[model samples]
Target: MRKILVVGAGQSGLQLALGLQSHGYEVTLMSNRTADEIRSGRVMSTQCMFHTALQHERDLQLNFWESQAPKIEGLGVSVAAPGSWAEGPAARAIDWVGKLDGYAQSVDQRVKMAGWMETFAQRGGQLVIHGAAVSDLDYFSRTYDLVLVSAGKGELVSMFGRDASRSPYGEPQRALAVSYVHGLGPRPEHPDYDAVRCNLVPGVGELFIMPTLTTSGRADILFWEGIPGGPLDVFNGVKDPAEHLSLTLELMERFTPWEYARATKVELTDGGGTLVGRYAPTVRNPVGRLPGGGLVLGVADVVVANDPITGQGSNSASKCAASYLASILERGEKEFDEEWMRGTFDRYWDAAQHVTKWTNAMLAPPPEHILNLIGAAGQLQPAADRFANAFNDPADFENFFYEPGKTAAYLASLS
Candidate 1:
């Protein structure tokens, strides 16, 4: 029997661990903290998981299958002028988000992580608390057939191999302040307002509002986005995040629903709804080889890419876990040697590179004509929907990555 050890209990690690167990591998998953330690109701960032992502999750039989995950109503996207962010061409996306087979909406990340860990253990998976820290990590034995690392935190980055991209994305961490509110008005007037309201402000960054089902019977709004000089940084000295948050929302009110009027009280997690800062640091393609890789493999955020802006982190992580598990099952421990594991690492990187490239390119500043094109497309219905779903298509992904042909296609297909 091959003994596999999975480090880091984040979503990626959890998915990989559960996947390996299902394939009849002797897997032991050890996370650094307990479930309650990480649980919090703060932000909503991801759209529904992609169809390919959902299928892999089901094939692996991840724990949250029966849990209350979202059935995405649709995507909420906006395109506005560079300076005037408050008002712009708004687009509502339902056909894509709402119709995704298994997952169109979202489940809380904290909940899913906790749920997966529990289920993995219930079905005879091993888990431990307080495993190896990245810097202090050193493999004791090659006894364990394979060791997979999927730590999302920064500490995990140093414990991996090199990146191999021409001009990989930069390391820019932004501060985001989020809060859940009740007693808000009806959804906005945007076309897909019934599904999701995406506020796209070029200079100000992004703000996404989604209705998520927590344990609470009533639907709650998760207000979230990353700001350059966000409240957490500018008001770092304030010492009261609740107050800072209230002010932040007030300043950015023009883009959101008219809900600020009814926010009676705010429930702050981590003592004030202050998240331990988030980053979208980019590096070259995952290293084909690490210094001392007897058989330690990279998974999810740790390997392929990092950045929640594209909302591909979680989906990519889930898919990577499946692919990683499949590889291990096909080839036993012997295949995990430094050379072989390097190949697996390369395979993982190759799979994620195209999507990462596409997202990174789109995130960069656009030219004059392209901006106008996006503005025009945002004004229409079908064009906007196709623009959003194109992310799920590889041809579109490549088009977006290499050229503006896809955007041109959107122009030609306008309603």
Candidate 2:
């Protein structure tokens, strides 16, 4: 292999570049700008790389946290329905997404991504600061031996062309609002204050709060969701950034009433919020093989894992990279075309579908099993804990993505 050209320099792209380079493959990472742009204290999307993602990093020995990054200890997950009590022994709590003192670490992926890219460059990997440019590649010409497209953006979908059967996605794409803010005006701390949280508030959507080591020294992140073209888009008519944060804080106070009872009210400070308006697309075929040789494909959030309800965006790509890398290393460039990409991705597709479908299923009117299950938990205390922990247990984790039946079975065991 002469050199692998990787498109898109996001988290997924960085991971693939590191993996390939570590395996002694020649790799050139091309992005809109140099890694220095990413290192300029900008955080794009917030991702909780749970233990699995961290293990992948450690396994590759890709650590850049000596000076700036902070290590995350754990995650607190609470699943609450709107208007429900969120505190006390009587209220229900969801399972923690990570094991105690485990490998899950919260990171400003933008910074860490740049650090890894710098490391890649130091290790002799080529860095190309080309913006939206790629030489047309045809395998017969044998231009690069292998061209891996990790492009996580929307336009990349058309690259592999289109296929009907394997790529049927029925859901429409939706816009989301994500912001990292600070000094949200201050709330008194609770007696038992546990920071670093992930929450799912029914009807109101999800928000993940993580501790960040930034210029402000310590900052928090808030990920908010709004219906496309809805009132929230214009910050519900608020004109300025502080006003927007105020509106979000206002809404948060109203909706997070349950959490507000115990958790500290966010104190918003001016100029501390950075908002990214994102449109996430749904995809059943994020991974597709091109018709010719010298090409293999994998889609991360880059391609379309917009189903953030499942948090598979980053993890899916990491797993996909591992799978795609394996496929390429096994079959070599000539054999690593669309077909083999399909074969390796089949495993990823099956795993992701099982969990995401179940997750998205929860958003709508509840299914009978869910109703019965939640109803059962309400009636039987132990059953609820067991049922909710389905998102955490190792067996539940494995089966959640790999075997829905097994996940169902684990839940059934408690009943």
Candidate 3:
């Protein structure tokens, strides 16, 4: 059996490891934290995964929480009108809900990752609990036929140098904060169904109200993507969960009153239900060279770390795992050399490029045509649904989202 070492116990790493194990590969999965530690840790992300990504999990039989997590039937957009902070909810500009062809769902990473770790062990794959460093990889590389780094954080990330041509930003784009809470009431506009509410406070930031399944039970996620140094970028030093939830609601009150009115009674699900941090969107070379001359392949966020403004982090990771799994399976007895590594990443990039382009585009200030596209979605159901489903298949954005001419043409056809 081909021996493989996967460093990182994240969504991508775990999924890939399990897939390889089923294929008769000797897989060793290493994680810095054990299942208990992960289950007891702070919130990692507001991973609202769309259908295609969810399907990837189902194919692997890893969708354990599917029956428990709320099925997000649609996504709604509410743009704060000019000076709406002062004018209140009555001044909201564009308001509409786009029904997704397939429902999306958000299961807290703490819950999902921990459950996956235990599942991996139960399935007979080797689970190693230790923080992996470059030296560790160098030593392990001698034993395993292949080494893959899926952990996007910590020192391992630095080994993969940034691809300057693909990495457009040098500094963080947005100040991100998340709070997982219970008791968030339903959106009155769509009370009958659960939906992902994206409230845009133009020039300030965005508030994503998500219905989620956490460790405790059904909960909601209040995520803020604030432009660096903006007024909403105030969660930097807040450590108290109560304080984080308080500030999250206060911001909602100031920017998205409609959401705040429903969130007034919410409370944190756990003491560790809040997270705050940020990183620039970057694409890195896939192969990392160790000091000892061994090579390791970078996966998921390790190679393409786009800002969460587009909520594509987990989705992209799932796709990366699925893509990489196919490449590895096809390699058949060939050496996992640097050439093969690059080729594999390039194959994954063929699909990932769309996600990278769309996410990077979202980070920047919206151009006139992009603004027009969003505005027109309010009046056109087909346009709204297309835009919402794009969250599941971002490659569709290439059809109309990037070029002003295409955007105009698309809206005209809808009209």
Candidate 4:
């Protein structure tokens, strides 16, 4: 059996390790936290999985929360009126819902990652609980036939040099804050709240509200993607979950009053339910070199670290794992050298590049064409549905979303 070392037991690393183990490869997964620690630790991300990504997990028999998690049946987009931003219902502008072709779901990473880690161990995969750094990669590279890094952040990630040609942004795209809370009442006007509600305050930032399954139970997640130095970028110095929750509510009241009204009764689910940070959308070279001169391959966020603005980080990670798994399986005793690594990464990049493009487009100020598309989506059910479903396959977005001519033609057809 070919031995493989997967550093970082995150979505991609764990998934690939388990997949290789099932295929009779000797797989050792190194994690910084054990399953118990992961379960009891702070929240990791606002991971809402659409159909394609969820299906990838199901195919790997990893969808443990499918039965218990709330089904996200649609997506809602609201654009708040400029200058009308205040603490009341009058601050709203236009709101509309778009039905999805299939449901999406958000399972808190604490629940999902811990469950996955335990399952990996139960299935006889070798698991190590230790932090890994670039200094250790030289030894790891010699020990395993192939080494794959998938951790999203930290010193290990810095080992993979930024590919400036592919990476457009030089600094953090948004100041991100997320709070998971319970006790949120259903929207009074639209009580059937089984959708990912995205409120865009053009020029300010965006807010995403979703039903998420947490360690405690079903709850709501409010994620703020604040443009740096903007009004929504107010999470600095807030460490306590209650304070985080209160600040989120205050921000909502100031920008999205409709959502604020619904969040009036909400409280942080736990001390670990809130997080604040920032990351530039970056694409790094897939192969990293150690000081001792060994090369290790990077997968998922190690190579493509998009801001969670478009909710594509985890989804892209899953796709990368699936693609890399296929490539590795097909290698069939061939050397896992630089050429093989580059080829594998290129295959994954074909799919990932679209996600990066679409996500970056969303981070920028909406062009007139995109505004027109959103308007059409509000009025036309088919347009709305198509737009929502595109989230499932971001690659398809290139056909319409980023191209002004295609978007105009699409809108013309919608009429």
Using lDDT, give the best candidate's number.
3
**Candidate 2 local accuracy as lDDT?**
0.55
Question: Which whole-number lDDT from 0 to 100 does residue 232 have in model 1?
Answer: 24
lDDT of each: 0.57, 0.55, 0.92, 0.88
lDDT, model 4, position 228: 98
Model 2 pairs in collision: 152-302, 152-303, 183-267, 183-268, 183-269, 184-267, 184-268, 185-267, 185-268, 289-338
Residue-level lDDT tens digits of model 1 in 268-379: 3334234324565554334323345443666777766655556676677777887777777778656577666667766676767766766665556656546645566546
Residue 104, candidate 4: Cα error in Å is: 0.6
Cα deviation of 41, candidate 2, in Å:
6.4
Candidate ordering by lDDT (highest first): 3, 4, 1, 2
The regions of model 4 sitting more than 4 angstroms off are 86-90, 188-190
RMSD of 1: 4.4
lDDT of 2 by residue, 215-291 (tens): 34455666655444543344534346666555655545554544444334555322434555544345545444444
Q: Candidate 4 lDDT, tens digit per residue, 84-132?
A: 7644443656678888888999989889889888998998888999898
Model 1 spans with C-alpha error above 4 angstroms: 40-48, 63-67, 80-82, 85-103, 134-137, 161-167, 180-186, 190-194, 215-241, 254-276, 284-293, 391-395, 400-402, 413-415
Looking at model 4, the pairs that clash are none
- List the lowest-lDDT window of 10 residues for candidate 4: 85-94
| Inter-residue clash pairs, candidate 1 | 72-104, 72-105, 75-93, 164-285
- Give the better candidate number (2 or 3) by TM-score: 3
* Number of clashes found in candidate 4: 0
User: Model 2, stretches more than 4 Å misplaced?
Assistant: 66-103, 133-142, 161-175, 183-198, 213-217, 227-240, 258-273, 278-280, 284-296, 302-304, 332-334, 368-415
lDDT of 3 by residue, 307-391 (tens): 9988899999999999999999999999999999999999999989999899888888889999898899999999889999999
